[model samples]
Target: MQQTIAAPQRDLRPLLALVATAAIGVFAWLAVSTEFGHSLAAYDPAVTTWTVRMRHGLVTAVAWPLTHLGGTLGLTLLTLAVCALLLLRGRREHALVLAGAMIGSSSLTVLLKLVFARSRPAASLLLGEPASSWAFPSGHAFNTGVFAGVLAGFVLFSTTAPARKVLAAAAACAAIVLVGLSRIYLAYHWLTDVLAGWSIALAWLCVVGVIVLTVRRRPRMLPAGGGPRAPAAGSGRPRDQA
Candidate 1:
């Protein structure tokens, strides 16, 4: 009975991957077609007032440092740390998946940035801080989405414990949200850029996650309900009481 239920759930994994792929396709279409340009431009700078406060020092006290975690080098190190943890846990395959997903997402962001060739917010709006990167999908948002996503996936599915899953999920979601918010507050990314980043990152994560789960699934010899199994006849087994 457990196998019967689990089989269907396993089958649905591929379909979920397909859905994520479709989302990526839609985002790419909108990007090339410029369908989101107007809204992106209009919304991009609307938060300038909030970020351009005179006490910018207060903002820099922690947010700027925290945002670096999404940067290429920072995220690379963090991914390695998680992979190491997974390795120590004897989940070598999951470690590989997590590493591949993160590294692949980072590379994708770099390539996409070049392909889009969209300029970052103008220097004037950046409060005199220099930001010299092409921005369509924010790297911070993309990397954070992927990293946090994989962690949450692990917490939710890799364990039998429910309380840990809920706690980890909440914490992971909050941290990822802060990463995106930090990007915007620093005048480093437009709203739509972060949205697109998240969209694509999630799509890719679903793909990687499904592939990993499929590859790592172990064969089970028993049903979900725990039950006793009688031993085969043997030479020395005692007969039933007469």
Candidate 2:
């Protein structure tokens, strides 16, 4: 009995670490984001000033697509497509986990926006960016972080090829960074809003990821006698060698 519990504890060490890290991130964001009516990441109007000032043709072109990709239709299609692919590959549970992670992040983003009711920067502050809604947490940054985190989890666990893993990780990380930066630069969200989004989604992924791992790693229950199941007659396999 003790051994059974011990085994699960060992298997859950990774999850414990992830949870600890996420707790710290959540606490830090909540502390910083709710202080004195502005967050450390967006304490200065100059931060927005400089970001708006950096707008140009090439950067705008690159940022437009990324923001769109993290948009409503784009994010929905991307999530469905990835979930569909995972289902096709017979990794049904992983597919579900992936879908749930992204969906949950998206849902929470909307809920938090409603709760905080933090308005975006003034229209006059906008250079070429769009800000037509609440801005406590950038939905794009939050959803993109979950997408990247879940995709990276799948890649790291499902594939063994070093090059493929590296490529996928790089792509996932790049997408997340670009999406967050786009939100900030486009003036769609404050810098702290993006940071809070990232923090929230990251904490969410770690939690969901732990649940999935726990389910997957559950050890098979043994027989009542505390031993492997005996093989059927004539099977020719040792019963104790399970």
Candidate 3:
């Protein structure tokens, strides 16, 4: 006779929820401080000044394209393209998740901008045309961060190749960092503003992930007999599989 034991299952919902809560708290604090016209972080000016001083023709050339890519029009178009591709491939869940992220992030960004009414760094702006909207939380950073996170999550969850996962993770990280940096380098936003955007995106993604996982684990409806629907022949799975 051979002895056998099943591995214990671990639930990650609690951990994910905790992270989401913490990130939300951080963004709220930043928003409140900005609304009151007080600087929460002492280094905001120092970082902004350093980035302004470091701007050059070469880097500005690079940052210009990146800034546009992470802008409102660019991100909106990119999101629509990606969702269409996912839908065409029959990945309905993935498409829905990406769409929700885009809508949620955009709505929250607009609401916060209106409520906080923080002004952009007018004197430090390097663009040919100045940004006229409120800019406490950089929209470019928020949208790009959320989009990169969704892409990374899809790759990690759907792919089995370790090398591919590594590449995906690296690409996602690079996108987030470069986009955020472009905002700062162009002097359109403060460093703290970028931080708040990233924090909110993290919280939003975690919440969406939790909801999807919960729905996926929900048990199916019972048959008319009410005992349990039998598993298909040769399937060998439990009849009550969620």
The lDDT leader among the candidates is 3
lDDT of 2 at 168: 85
**Candidate 2 lDDT, 27-123, residue by residue in tens:** 4666456545555754646777888887898998898899989877889999899889889999798788878887788788788888888777767
lDDT of 1: 0.75
Candidate 2 vs candidate 3, TM-score winner? 3
**Cα lDDT listed for each candidate:** 0.75, 0.77, 0.84
Mark the 10 consecutive residues where model 2 has the least summed lDDT: 1-10
Task: Tell me the spans in candidate 2 whose CA falls farther than 4 Å from its real position.
Answer: 1-31, 38-44, 127-132, 221-242
Please list all clashing residue pairs in model 3, or write none if there are none: none
What local lDDT score does residue 84 receive in model 1, on the 0 to 100 scale? 94
Per-prediction TM-score, please? 0.79, 0.80, 0.84
Q: Which residue pairs overlap in candidate 2's backbone?
A: none
Give the alpha carbon lDDT tens digit for every residue of 173-197 in model 3: 8999899989988888888789888
Is candidate 1 or 2 superior in TM-score? 2
Count of clashing residue pairs in every prediction? 0, 0, 0
Residue-wise C-alpha lDDT for candidate 1, range 56-99, written one tens digit per residue: 67776667777888788888899988899889999887787788
